[model samples]
Target: MFLIFPVLSYGNNITLDEMLNMIDIKNFDKKIYDLEIEKNLSKEKFYNLDSYNGVKGEADIKYDYDKDKYDTNGKLTYGDFYVNISKNKISNDIDNGDSEIICGINKNLKNIIYSKSDSELKKLDYLKMKDKFYYLDKLESKKIDLINLYEEYKNNEFETKLKSNNLSKLKTEEKILKKSYELGAIPKIDLQTLQVSRENLEIELKILDKNLKKIKDRFLYEFNIDISNKTLADIQVKQIDISKYIPNIGERYLQSLDLDRKITIENINYLSYSNKVPDISLGIERKKETHNNTNSENRIFLKVSKDLFYYDVNLENEKINLAQQNINYRKENEKNISNQLKIQENYNNFYRNYIINKNKANLESNKYEIMKKKYTLGNITYVEVMDVFEDYLKFEVEAEKAKNLFNGYIYEIMVRGEKNHE
Candidate 1:
């Protein structure tokens, strides 16, 4: 006996859990996110060197030709060469070769201090990219969609068989009705109406068959498994406790936003100290002279400078306003999370309702089987049997649709909801 829901003994079959486990990490979106994290890590290295520039080297050489004493006093003069360990360059005296070489190393103290905040921001960005839950949630959602597609295909396959059976029965009825009309016991219009009904059903069946093949092909392409002879195991719905379903605000969007807030705070702190620190450079000068005798002298010096007209004059105001902006952003995100949780509750309720629908469909299916038997035994009219069949089919289709919805909601909550379900 064929049942509405049955375990088919097919040569090949796969469970939903098994199919989900078959997810190839190579094809997963998380790999792309990992690349992004690596890129951010490289940025962190760049921020580490933001305060220092490489040594700037300079050299000069000249010939001091005394035209007045051209016969005997003309002399070759060698200029000094020095490496300045700073961003700025010192010019050499190409005209006289008397240039003093100031080979010094200096650093902007403010840049070293500001680099901390830059490094902190990059690190926060790296952490945000490294969090894998977002990609995982998306993967889970995709799996749910594939499951639903398979379930729908299975239901359509069953419906096509049922319609074929009905068409066969109608063909028999038409044969009987045509003979009755010839015998003047039935009207010609009755036979004609049955023929029209049969034609319409054939068209519908054709469309269903086309859709079945399309779905089968899609499933094979996606999972690399031919499900033509396979059936998906029923989706198991987990009982959820909404009261205990506290969403993890530290995994995906909320986590990223919070990191952004931290980065902003770091920037604001850096701005507060930016003006207090001046550009300070400490270096030594080495001078060489070749006027009459070669001589060298070394001297150490300290340089301090501040921007009289600070480029970021509004930095203090920006620091004050940025904190308020961050607070507002966090508040909006929290509100959005709250709204999503409420929608999740609605999804949970829908899944529960579908569970009841599946049970009702089973009962109606049994009733339909009994009615068909009575019609075969001549205890019920053909029309009466068809009415019961229609009701049964309605429930069956609804139950099938509900199954997909049930699975979708369960998976969504388990993977993306407040609790870590997987």
Candidate 2:
């Protein structure tokens, strides 16, 4: 390790234990937690919209009025039943329909869509994420095992079937050159080609080792724990319950799949009441003039207001119908997803096969190992050696892929809920 202040002395500010302890395990799940918090925060902001706009303030102000002339009797207006506050200051605060109550619902939906768990294609991603964590967890458990593996690689011999293949090629080239020299079948220039081929193969193995070390380092860095390296073994292949998520397809309007279905139903109710009725208003007014002006006129007034959804019945019925259509649309999609889930559920048999493949690959690699040993001892032909080595690499990659597929199914179970779960 390189020290930043090797030449300078600095006092310790925090103990190593304290510094390490500061890194919280909670940080691992911070992504989902933070999104939920943000969603709620946006809801709080949406709820504050009414207060933020100052409570829909209303007031009536008047300049001049004598107590006796105005309402000394305190009688109600002539053509109105409601009290008239002429020459009196009146103010009221009320909701003016700017509450953004709807905004809160939309915002919640937006946040859910943004979060990882709520992704439409969440199944595969969920499994992949688990794999990352699982891989890390396994490595964490097997620190000692990993160290042993590394040590084994460092001291024990590196063997591959390729070497036997190269040796056979070398012998064959030598045999061909000897015959050519005797019969003048070809010039000495051809000998350089065979030598160069072997030289290239040697360089290729060195390059492959370098690449393998780079891959190992990436896995190690993620899996490493600061304490001790104890390599864990016997990892059980995990299975995903693809049935659960697809079963979730049955309820698009269900709370588990959609967090806001309840509020949406409420909103639909509220909006449904909007065109129910209109408010009416009554007013009274009186005017007086001195002898110099002329006679005074007093008047009583009544006013009524109403909003009829005549034109909108045609245009806006679509909106309510739209909600219904969406519910049905989502329901249909849920059915499709459910059907797909069943198909995947049947493939649960494949998950077993996936596990089988995982084990089979290991077996193939083991066979390659045995054949490699035999070839190295010159008991097998070079072609057989190359085939084994190539098969081993392919099997290793295939096993990892199969493990991931099983994980995908298991993730489905977590996302899907119980009866009436939607």
Point to the candidate with the largest TM-score. Answer: 1
Candidate 2: misplaced stretches above 4 Å? 1-235, 238-268, 281-303, 313-324, 327-332, 339-380, 407-422
Q: Roughly what TM-score does model 2 have, to 2 decimal places?
A: 0.41
Mind giving the per-residue lDDT tens digits that candidate 2 earns over 1-422? 11311121114332222212332232233344446556555554544342233322233433334421211112232211223222322123232211100000011222222332222223333333343344333323343333333323322113323444555666676686667657975455555544555565576667656654554453334322221222222223334444555555334333322333333443444444444434433334444433333444556555555577445453365466657766866886767677766756656765776778779888987897798588557686545655665566556556655554454334323333323211
Tens digit of per-residue lDDT, candidate 1, span 45-113: 666545343433343333335432111122221222234221111234233323233343445455555
Question: Over all chains combined, what TM-score does candidate 1 have?
Answer: 0.70
True-structure RMSD, every candidate:
8.6, 15.2
C-alpha positional error of residue 43 in candidate 1 after TM-score superposition, expressed in Å: 1.9
Distance from true location, Cα of 42 in model 1, Å: 2.7
Candidate 1 error regions (>4 Å): 1-11, 51-96, 111-141, 154-158, 161-201, 219-231, 238-246, 249-251, 308-337, 359-381, 418-422
User: Total clashes, candidate 1?
Assistant: 1
